[model samples]
Target: MALWSGRFEQGVSEGAQRFGASLPVDRAMYAQDIAGSIAHARMLGRQGILDAADVERIEKGLLNIKRQMDEGTFVWDLNDEDIHMAVESQLIRDVGAAGARLHTGRSRNDQVATDTRLYAKELLLSLVDGNDALRKVILTSARTNFGVIMPGYTHLQHAQPVLFSHHLLAYFWMLTRDHVRLVAAWRSADANPLGSAALAGTTYPLDRAYTTELLGFSHPIPNSMDAVSDRDYLLDLLYACSVSMMHLSRLCEEIITWSTTEFGFITLSDAYSTGSSIMPQKKNPDFAELTRGKTGRVYGDLMGLLTTLKSLPLAYDKDLQECKEGAIDAAGTLQDAMACVGGMVATWQVNADAMRAQASRGFTAATDVADYLARRGLPFRDAHEVVGELVLYCERRRKGLEDLTLKELRSFSPLFDDDVLEGLDPEGIARARTTYGGTGHEAVKTQLREAARQLGRDRRQASSLRGRMPNVTGD
Candidate 1:
């Protein structure tokens, strides 16, 4: 039966009931719901709103229900409507009158808000952990392939030579920002929303602070109306997820391109690759393509929630019932994508020789050649013109700039010398950039050191935040 059956004159059709139910989406939060109930019951007893005997029965009954859920033995029914009702109705059946009294000082509005916040807080920490794992994989890849040089591109055309480590660290920094967003989202969900009752403070002298302490919220949400109405934490989480997915998509796009026969800079592991049905020679980077594809779906999850929330009035609305599924879907999607991408990165074979072979193609060393002449007292614009002519001279003969003899090089510009020829080597060209955060070998080592320190700090902070979860040791 529905929780409000006492007030309804007649029941709705089964189709309408099923359509109205949030149980399917919210069942993912059963553990949080039971924990919230236990804390609420304890708070009621402490505030003298419920006697000791009833609180005991309520706590034990909720724990029993939680066990059933944990053991995957909890029976579900469509009439339960939502997780709050599902647990409450079952608790009532398990412990009779005491279970009925458990909701005496609360409403599903505040209860759901509280449960969702708790769930969000915990989920953010897990995301932080997952993000950290990927960042570590990136750092490891950078370290393992430290001196491997590759062509860095702008506009998808070869622009310069850069270390493979430098390319990988670009992604590491992107995920570092993603970790920040996830933690910020966690803090957004840290405030407790219990004891707000429906849309107003209840007559019962409920000790909200005690419940906050029990649930490990940083503080109680100050206003009753906003407490039950707000779904901003989910927005924070969804935004974080969307941004992280975008970052993953960018990396995966590179992975997909690099794994191609044309690039051949890296090879996806057989575990992460798949073969075409018709062509035995095909080993497609399907997982990378999948991650890239899933990025759009996660973006849709964020937009779906934003659109659902755009025109709602103050306090709780049925529109808020449209909230949970998107956040849940986004989180699960992000977690799975992270796992797949992390594994793909960890096991993939880096084609260092192939990467190095193509690192200096398409006159990639042209900029350094220009720099070389500019350093030799020629006007930089003149040096640029000189190099442009030199490039044409080399192209006409079907030879590389390095392939030009000294006499041939000097014929284009007096600044052309042996050192300019020496600088044409791809590794020297990449290593010449010694500026901080540049693609230089020593600069990359500096970046890797700082990345290690940042990873340590983030790991510690995530661990501390996780420690604040209620029943961290498990109830």
Candidate 2:
């Protein structure tokens, strides 16, 4: 029988029945729902709403249902609509009157909201850990290539020389910002909403603050109407996931480019790459490509939920049911993608010789040569013009700036001395950038130390949260 059939004169049509059901999607929340019910039952007993015997019966019946489900002995009915009704029906069958009393001051709206919050709180820590793992893989790669130089580009044209480590650490900082966004999302899901029945507050003299304390929530939700209706926490999480996926997509894009024969800066392991069916020499970075492609689907999940919530009224509506699937999809997609990227990076080979070879090509040290001239009393604009002429001379002669003799270089600008040859070296170009965040070797070491510290902090925080989260009562 339907849980809400008392008000209907006839059964719902098959199409309406199937359309209204959320059992297939929401069945994943069964454990959280059961945990919440157990907490609520104990609270009800303490509030004198039920006797000790009744509380024991309700708890036993709930646990029994959980056990049956775990053992695969329970049948989930499609017509049950959602996890809440399905569990409650079994509770009633097991414990009779006391099982029916379990719903004395609760509604599925508040119940599901509480369950989602608990679930979100747990997942936020997981996503943070995943972010940390990916960051560590990047930092390790950076540390391994500290002295290797690369041609830094502006508008896809060679602009200057830079340490490869500095280039990799840029993505590390991007993931750190992504971690901060996820922390905010975690806090958003930390409020307790279980006492806000249906739409308005319940009338059973229930202590919402007491439940919040038991559940380890930061606080009870301040407004009852907002408690059951709010899905902003889910939106915050999906937004974080979407943005993190985008960051990963950018990194994946670089990996794909770097692994190609044209760049040849790195080579992905055979496990992470695939070969073309007809071409024996083709080793494709398919994993990285797929991660780039998954970014769009995660973005779609964000937009889909935003559209669903836009047209709804202030209070709870059926439209809210559309929110759950997107959150689950976004979280799962990011989690898997992060794991795949981390594994790929941990074992991939870095071609340091190839990276160094490409670093000095195309007059990449022209900026340092211009700086040398400027330091010798030439105005920067004049020094830039002088360097441009020297670059043009090198291009016309099919030679490099380093190939010019001191007399030849001095012919272009009398400010040039034998010391000018040092400025044209790629290694010297990278080492000369001694600014706090520049591409120098010392700067990268400082960055590595800081990145390691942050990774340790994230791992510790995730550990502490996991320990506390399991004991959180649904009340």
Candidate No. with top lDDT: 1
For candidate 2, report its TM-score: 0.96
Per-residue alpha-carbon lDDT of candidate 1 for residues 202-261, written as tens digits (9 for 90 to 100): 999989899899899999999999999899999999999999999999999999999999
Clashing pairs in 2: none
Tell me how candidate 1 scores on lDDT: 0.91
lDDT of 2 by residue, 18-133 (tens): 99888888887777788888878888888998899999998888888887777789888777889999999888887898989999899888999998888888778889989988
Candidate 1 weakest lDDT stretch, 10 residues: 466-475
Off by over 4 Å in 2: 470-475
RMSD (Cα, Å) for all candidates, in order, is: 1.2, 1.8
RMSD in Å for candidate 1, one decimal?
1.2
